[model samples]
Target: MELQDHIMHGVFHSNGFGHLLCLNGLEAVAGSNLSGRQIMNFWDHLCNALRARKVSLNDISTKRGMELRLMHGIAYKAPWFGSWGYKFSRGSYGVIQPMYEKAIDTLRAMPLCILVHYLGSSNHDIPIIFSRYQMLSDHSLTTLGDMFQFMLELKTRMAEENLLDSYTGPGMFVEQSCRWSPKRIEMATRAIVEALKRADFRWVSRQEVRDAARIYIGDTGLLDFVLKSLGNHMVGNYLVRRCLNPVTKVLEYCLEDVSNIVPTQDPKVKTTIHQYRMSKSQLMKDMLYLYKHILKDYPSSLNVGILSVVPTAVRIILDAKYFAKEYHEDQHQARVEIGSEDKLSVYCTIMLRNNNINIEGTTTTLPPLLPPFECVRLRRSATFNELMVEVEKIFRDLYWGMKNLILDSVANLEANGKDLVFGQVEVGGKVIFQGSNKGGIGEEMMYYEGGSNWNKVVVCGCGAREDDGERMVSCDICEVWQHTKCVGIPHHQPTPQIFLCKRCENEIVTLPAFP
Candidate 1:
């Protein structure tokens, strides 16, 4: 019978209460027995309606329409919607009729055979139905077993089309399928191993390995499986290290030979080692340059006596044995002994006496000293790069220590109203301090006088020292010096006698005036 005829007969012949009653009371008999062909025709029509966008699955299952009410039974098994003889009194019937609503409900309670019939059919709309399986299952329209069948069929179809390799579907589905395929795991592992072997024992990112092996490892678990497979001693004796890629900053793997200390062909590792060594060597060269420049005769255009003490102060701090012990104790805790601090104080006193520079009543505190390592022992398996880093750290600490010592001595002499002077003694061609002489002592000697003070200078507005060779002018109000160029004053112009700094001018403008 035509669908419209069934709806007309069911709607018009029903009771006055608006409940649908089929013609000749056939609803009771029809609900008891639903045929497979009738169910297939209903699903086919629903699929066609869905494809044309005339009705959505949500509208069919949720709206109060006799034609689409059966979908609630099929999709959700809603008790009120699925109950026999329940009347849906709204929404016009689109494709389904009122008579078949009972039949569709009966089909909904049947076994999975009806689904098999629909899926196995040669209908062109089956693929569209397959795509909506997730949508159907999401609404509880299909069972777990139904979803399993859908996946199997979809995978089989993809394999038949030679599109499985290029299929970029959900990763969970691929992983589940791969998990059950032992042969695929083995092949992927072999490919990854070959890729690593070609990498020449260097670090490689996972994406790099994927491209090199031409195998898609979409998830970490699969890659982990391949790594575990490589760990088998029978496969290869590879030492695997998981480190961050220096360039990309991503986690990567380095598979190397167990016996090899370093990858000889890896330029990055070699370059890093060379950089560390060059840094250490450059630091040593700088230290020597500082010593030689300080001991050399000054240009007579600069302060020689104040600057000459810098090398001597550095030498005195470097020669202190207590400083060396402190550095060794800092690096190795097991070597620390009781009363170490007290012993360090005693050694400081001895070092001061040995230098013969007395600071009896002055505020000249000693600067903290860092030790340069006199001896270093490396393990047989340690790489040269590691040794270079350790040595570099030691030299860096010593360099900064020497710098701090020189600055501390100069500051103390300035604070105590004393000027630095060269002393009169020479030991091993390096001048040693006994006491200050009027005609000036040798270059390496350091002395301080009780009554001498150097000229006091203030920093300029350009954050440079007074001796920086920039032409400067002093503000008349605050007396703070500032560079002429920094204040927009032309160099060739004569200095203004009543110059005021920007800060003092702003302060004067901000002050309250008398009425």
Candidate 2:
């Protein structure tokens, strides 16, 4: 019930998550007692035509001709449709039936499994059915029991609180904002986070942080929203210090070769895969290089740009303290032109300021990039399902690409007469391919490791991901490992140095207490 509550009432756009899960639960309830057709006002018969929209059995739709074709949306990621505000949109809903039918064929969504589907392409970790353990991006369980136990405890709390109604679950009935404005987003965020804290929910906060993001783009340039929304705001000053190394390490590893990405049949396929991997590899490296050489000193420097699909063009600026300001364009301007893809865009310049995102002291103005450089591109879409399709396309291309790059990088360096090549990894440590000077790449994906909870996502939160998690140092104080990238420190830091995380730095005393 608690899981249902969480699924149903997400801040930005999560109805699809709840709607689908409720359909599953309703199916079981309907199955148990053939005569029990109604639970509260949610009638079992209502599911007659709607049931096709609700249940998981591949054949459930056989009772009716209607089928669901859903996918994950990038903003407020839920299994959404083609256009903005799709759930309430008839235009958007029309497109989903065909699209969702193609994507939601995973095992948990199969048959009648009651797995907690998180909905959409979870940036950090995805929900796994019949398994509690979260398989890392490379597909390994990073933690055990937390995601599953969180559910058990949530159900217990709902029962104890006497708040568990057939119709009303946790946030199952809360109304989310029409758009994620900074104020509206922050309010929804505070409510969910506070509620989860009271329930003693161990994880899922980071996932919430991402889902309720306030930054946005309309037909106007520079979405007038909060910086916390534009960036990984969950990373406090302490985490920016601790996690920067891991971010660098991961980027470095991404440069190296990986192994065990699923293989294919032909040689030409292999070569194409190599180009994709190298292109991505080169992109990541170039991003890092630009941040260090140019953006590091000049925040207002117009030298930066990014390549992505968005209706409006905007720029963003961030300082250590999360200082933010916005510029705007005409409000009534039309969103889509004669031809363009439906998507959101966020941009910020690389500026370093202590309490100052604007440099006032001594500084040198670097020349603007001749071609207008871009660091990294952030993609946005109306639904995670569309994002998933694009992401799947990338992964399909990158799957063999990631694997081939790993192998080729190793082979190339070995042939070049390097002292060291590929490093063997220990069970729960960093996966590195070593060299005389920080060489070789390791596979980002690992296989799944089952945990105590057999029916939940392995882990929760954006921070719990294995790709970024291994290099991060946990704060003895707050305990959350921290989000990716840097704010308080340099992108690359010298290792073996004793450091205090920002929570400790600010003298944080204890963790939040349950109500």
Tell me the spans in candidate 2 whose CA falls farther than 4 Å from its real position. 1-470, 495-497, 508-515
Candidate 1 runs further than 4 Å off: 1-456, 462-466, 476-479, 485-497, 502-515
TM-score of every model?
0.17, 0.14
lDDT (C-alpha, whole model) for all candidates: 0.34, 0.23
Residue range 222-323, candidate 2, lDDT tens digits? 122222222211211100000112433421100001111111125443222111111323322333332232223322422223211111111111110011
* Candidate that scores best on TM-score: 1
Worst 10 residues of 2 by lDDT: 235-244
Q: Rate residue 164 of model 2 by lDDT.
A: 22
Alpha carbon lDDT at 345, candidate 1 = 9
